[model samples]
Target: MNNIVEAKGLVKSYGDFKALNDIDLTIPSGAISGLIGPNGAGKTTALKSLIGLCDVEGELQVAGRDPRTSRHKLMEDVCFIADVGM
Candidate 1:
């Protein structure tokens, strides 16, 4: 199955602390996936990175588009649970 979200070698750091390291993720369309780990395990960081909430390093894409460069375009097809939707 093709993936709606994909990340390769995803890395996020705060100063000297590394929140995400060498992370690889793939979430296919119409599939439910969960991120699980101990506290400060980078789940939030990864999710934010994918949704273009924050800038991080490494290759990341959403729906076959680059989130870093095409965030607005990608967001059009994405929905956040907490946001008002129509």
Candidate 2:
């Protein structure tokens, strides 16, 4: 099956702290998934990156499009309910 979301070597840093470190994620198409972790565990940061609300290093693709460049188009197909989504 194809992936609805794919990320490789994802990283997000805040000042000197690394919120996300070399993260690799994959969500298969038509699958329901969630991120679960304690506070400050980069859950929010990951969501922010996935939804195109924040910028991070590495390659990421959602709905077969890069969230950094094709965010407007990606939003049309993917729905993320969090921070800004609320």
* Global local distance difference test of model 2: 0.90
Mind giving the per-residue lDDT tens digits that candidate 1 earns over 1-86? 88998899988899999999998888999998888899898878888888788788888989998888999998899975532331
Task: Give model 1's TM-score versus the native structure.
Answer: 0.88
Which candidate should be chosen as best, given TM-score against the real structure?
A: 2
Candidate 2, 1-86: lDDT as tens digits: 99988999999999999999999999999898888999899988888898788899999998899988999999999776665543
Off by over 4 Å in 2: 83-86
**Model 1 local distance difference test score:** 0.85
Candidate 2 weakest ten by summed lDDT: 77-86
Q: In model 1, what lDDT does residue 22 have? A: 91
Candidate 2, position 57, lDDT: 100
